[model samples]
Target: MSTPMGRNVIALEWLQFGLGRLVAAAAEEGLTIHLLTGERSEYAHELAELDSPHLVVHDVNTHDVAKVITTIRAIGDVAGLLNTTDTWSLVSLEVRAQLGLAGPDPACIRLVRNKALLRRRLYEHGLSRADGSPLADTDDAADVAARVGLPLIVKDSAGTGSEHVWLARTPDELTAALDEARRVALRGHLIAEPYFLGPLYSVETLTWEGRTRVLGVSSRILSAPPVFREEALAFPVALPPAVAADAEQWIEQVLKCVEYTEGFAHTEFILTDDGFEVVEINPRLGGGLVGEEISQTLDINLYATFLDLVLRRRPALMDAPLTPSRGAAHARLYAPRTGIFVGCQGQELLSGHPGGPVLRPALPAGTAVRTIAHQDGCVAVLFATGATSELALQNVLSAAGEIHVRMEGDDRG
Candidate 1:
């Protein structure tokens, strides 16, 4: 039996939007969450407001693995931990193993965190797009691009949140992508592989006793081609039950192949004309307010549930069904151009609508902003739940338009 610990630690790198939600969930569950971040983030004030007990904010530089281990030990009796950031997972799992903490197996974590390792494992399990290989150098990238055809994808071996991902169409493009990828690869490791053009989505699941249970699917909206910016996400896909069933089936295989056990897994996949092909799996909740959506609608605090599992507490009984009756849509709001934020226009309007949007904006006025590729300078997020998918989309779009990002930039130029 997994012993449930009354005291828990939430070792967060940064408390932006998602971590904040995790903190709130932990608080609601009557668990103590310790905030851990580097020296630079201004996350303390926001966390202090939560009034969590012994909210020990530590400046454990995640890069220094030694210091991290020391810090974890210092937070004595912190029976279990939950991570809200991707970059911290590798370190967290490593530290957890060293401390005899229970969670997703460390090897499973390694496979999911490293893109190359993930692809290789998925391919071995017959879950990949087709013949693919991890690149060794710029020369290898060019070779793969040619063999895979134009429009190839080059990814970082240990990059998170699509930071070092790129797509190329020609020799020039491939070279440029390789340069950018090399710059962003973690510890300087990169993978160049074939790009699969298709609809992108995420399979959210919670595993217990090795059973991967579905918790709805999210359709991802990308910012632009060749960039990693995720503009939006929606839930309750309109795909027929049969197709969704197939997706669930595929997820089971992925969980087993990757050897993922216990805890949450956010599996990304491309639904192509060929079929569903695996994108890397995240051994945690799908990012971008997914936990919030699940919590609000299904009455499940995924963060709490994760803590419970890690502590070996009795799993939170899900009286509610996983499938949502009405579809929900979440849109990322970014500056149409680039400049310092002057404030969003209609936050009240966006929040006023009862069913229109569940507004969660990370940035407010006076925050410096830019229109960088693969980065949403999101001023706000508009979440809408409606009876039908179209209605939900319309509500979200309407709310998004109402909340305008005021920026000063050379639009004409």
Candidate 2:
């Protein structure tokens, strides 16, 4: 039999990314993970090679928060809880409080999840250009035009991964989006606001006791207008000393405004001609290789700090001086048309390219990709690293250009 770590940490249903890092962090901290997930297959990719001694999976209906709480109470030596998913974060917070474990405040989690409320709060504080107007079921295109104006974005206030988000430049497009919103179910009510114009970037930070550290910024390369889908991302984007300092100061204020006491935050913003405008603040690490990529870039496992927070200890990251020794980037693999995923065509070509590009598959073969307009159609991510952000981005793009996603019905591959 192997040695045992008597202490245990709780992980609610997690996002597909970052489980490996979280598991390693737990082990290093002398705490095994009691993962309460509704579906074990969601983590199949990571669990295959995981340190089995450090993690124990429990199947429970995470959606049913009451049942989730009861399950946690039965798990022995459960000292703290952590969750990176938008779907289960709230449930985790509730369970933490019921069990008397250290965690983020309940109100703070709810406020950040509601985009409309966050926009209004920031607008009141002059951090945003305009407040988002609530879209009622009875409201129409003209109502939105009069309230938030045209060229607006209509989105579910609680949406994740760019799902259920629509951009309309014309009144006709706005009408169509509104009609579609009526037909579909939303996690939260619809919210409309004037679209901020500029490139997108998400600043990853670690916070404790109202103090924050600006880890690094990731350049979000999104698709062309009408759809807000992510395409690629490069970390540690070069910024002037003053520009970087401004972002740091603004992020500190934003955190204070939300009364966020602790934990990681991935704040997405638009760099407009006027200045940086608040987009949405995710109360966890950036999704999909963002945590892993940044850990490599900084030469440190930031997830270690996550466990530190749950144990109610000062996160070492808060005191440590970070030096980003390398750069990293990732590009999404997209199929030309909606069909069943087979594999990639030119992955072999990546061995000849720079940056040491690695292809990470999100979906297994035979899985169907029904659409390319959103994140679901992104079959895999191609990650690469270099000495600088520009070079890493260049190498990733070059390697990605050679690889063509092979779909069942798409002939282009």
Candidate 3:
């Protein structure tokens, strides 16, 4: 089917941060954006405040796939469907397939949603060295530990944001991790793999009209183990020429193996002594302002580029080769412990500093706080840019140090 021209596009589960940008992009291109989301989304009021004729919000239980499809069909003439959040990718694929819109094959998308399946496909293609196996709920923890060995990572098969991911260094820890995994597994299944010891990185890519291109790479700073939370990220980080080439090659091969021929992908992996150990590939841009950082440093609107791909129009960024003009970094701030939220201080100090970071606070004053165990618990994100990677990273760090969150009922000083 040919792509629809300047028609309505349906976005599954619209929220402020990323989906807002996409909606604005669509509106700018003369396309109407219909945002479908659950009734309870916190950003519902914010979406209403857009007050644009090109944007509309529809409330439905996003988890109810059948009801969602019915609502979309009732609305009629949805030209395309898009989803940046992991929870909505499959739903978007199903909706697009049903609406005869442009998107990757649902089967191909399954390879990304299912972690164990992805790892198996990579191993079959000789693209990864990590060993992983599907775990069962009834399996004995000790026996499973003996089989997979100690110092393993356990996580849900379809989890997102590293939630429910646990690192276990002993049999007892394995049991505890398994219990936690069982609580959060959407499909009641989990996977166990040897814990990789190396620096973690993510490669962002964009595919259009059967061709894929590497957009950029970001180095990750993960919080210490037990639970993995990404604390900071720096993009356009320099890599050895040979290593960069090989990593890009590996990403392309993996895309082929999964038959992912369209859309954006954020592929995470660990740089080991031998080569890249495949982390799960996400079928969207990196979370936490990575796309915004990319747009600022590379001078391209990724959200607009994504719309181009969906409409089957060639993206202009692809026409001319582009590179990062400046280094960019993002750092997230979390509460030190569970308490009653008060406010943050030292914003004035960083506000006038050269290369100061752009701060985005997630919570308001008086909200209850909790000990941050995962990325979802972050309260604010800070983004900064500089002439070089080291300088950008330094700016973000210095800015983070100047800011401090005060909470009631917490005494960690």
Candidate 4:
């Protein structure tokens, strides 16, 4: 078990927002990036501004899948197995079939990480119009609102960043979201569906074998829901060249309904008024500063397609030559309740705003903002740039409305 010489890889733990662009796209090509991590301080601002020697920071325990497959089987002869992270993509699909490497098909990443069997398998292949009801401890809420009706949506079926998800709408808000989902604290289980409204978008593909390419369209400024947070994001959302080629042929039939061939997905849908529906398919990539706002507004690096899908090959983002210079966007800084975060204030006037809005910081000062109803109260973020995407979302919402986030809730962390 000792073969490492040059291109060694294995990043089973990542995505506290693209660890410094995955260590500068694993230092060009002569890769390295070990990082097995079980919380290297959830990447302290990408390991405090990485100076990368092709990264390598392993602590392990990564939620103990047999102690992360007995520590990447003593790291040897590596060159495949990287996960942008949906809570570790089934631990890199059980460490790539217990170390044969090359991924996909751990039963298609457990049917795309089981959103109650991907909404009843895309409502039995009709590509979903709704059908996900799993919440049984003797089911209630009028049997999931007589099969997911009145503005439903009680998520978690293997949730992530939009944390637990809830959004009821009535029946006393689905019995107060099932009494706050029987004392909320779940990473996956409760289900229910049907909340297809509008305005939300993600699709930033990259596939190889099953061939996908869209790599654009972001626009998702949520927050005014039964609670899902997610406040700002903007990117190539212009759509209308025949509606961006029919949203890239409906996300290539929703990544061929989850066969999702090679690397990178980030799906999320909901164009509504009768069209693109899907709203949960993050096999990874669109979480905060979305892959660094699409590699700084599409100049494109996209972690060099996760170093050619952990080095199996063929992924220069599927025939490059794409372009789109400026226009990026990001925005978060949730603090209107639950507190102790103590920081941020006009961020030194964000480099005299415009597009220099930087900020970042997600939870650090005394950290203890328990629940602003998910995404752990997103303590900070700003990121801007413009010339499109509605002027980079109005320059990150005018530099996140001139900063100001200093929590306290009677202090105590």
State every prediction's TM-score relative to the real structure.
Answer: 0.88, 0.95, 0.91, 0.32
Clash pairs for candidate 4: none
Candidate 2 residues lying further than 4 Å off, grouped into runs, are 1-6, 410-413
Task: Give the Cα error of residue 148 in candidate 4, in Å.
Answer: 2.8
Better of 1 and 2 by TM-score: 2
Instruction: Look at candidate 4 and tell me the lDDT of residue 129.
Output: 76
Q: Model 2 clash pairs? A: none
Clashes in each model (backbone N, CA, C under 3 Å)?
A: 3, 0, 0, 0
Residue-level lDDT of model 1, residues 1-413, one tens digit each, is 84655476656564354555656666676666666678523453355455555356777787776887788777777767677567788778777777777776778777777777777777777788564557775465447766667777877777766667778878888888777666652643767666888889898888887777888787788877777787777775667889988988889988988878777778888999888887777777776667666665565555667656756765663333665667677778877767787766777775567456866655656777755564446666678877755566667877777777777553457
Model 2 alpha-carbon miss at residue 1, Å: 34
Off by over 4 Å in 3: 14-16, 39-51, 183-188, 364-371, 408-413
**Better structure of 2 and 3 per TM-score:** 2
| Per-residue lDDT of model 3, residues 339-406, tens digit only | 67677788888877657687776666676766578765677778899897667888898899988977
- Writing each residue's lDDT as its tens digit, candidate 4 over 204-276 gives 8878777888888888888888777788888878888997898899788878887888777888888877788
Worst 10 residues of 1 by lDDT: 39-48
How well is each residue in 27-51 modelled by candidate 2, as lDDT tens digits?
7777888889888877777777686
**What does candidate 1 score in Cα RMSD to the true structure?**
3.1
lDDT of each: 0.70, 0.86, 0.78, 0.79
User: Which residue pairs in candidate 3 collide?
Assistant: none
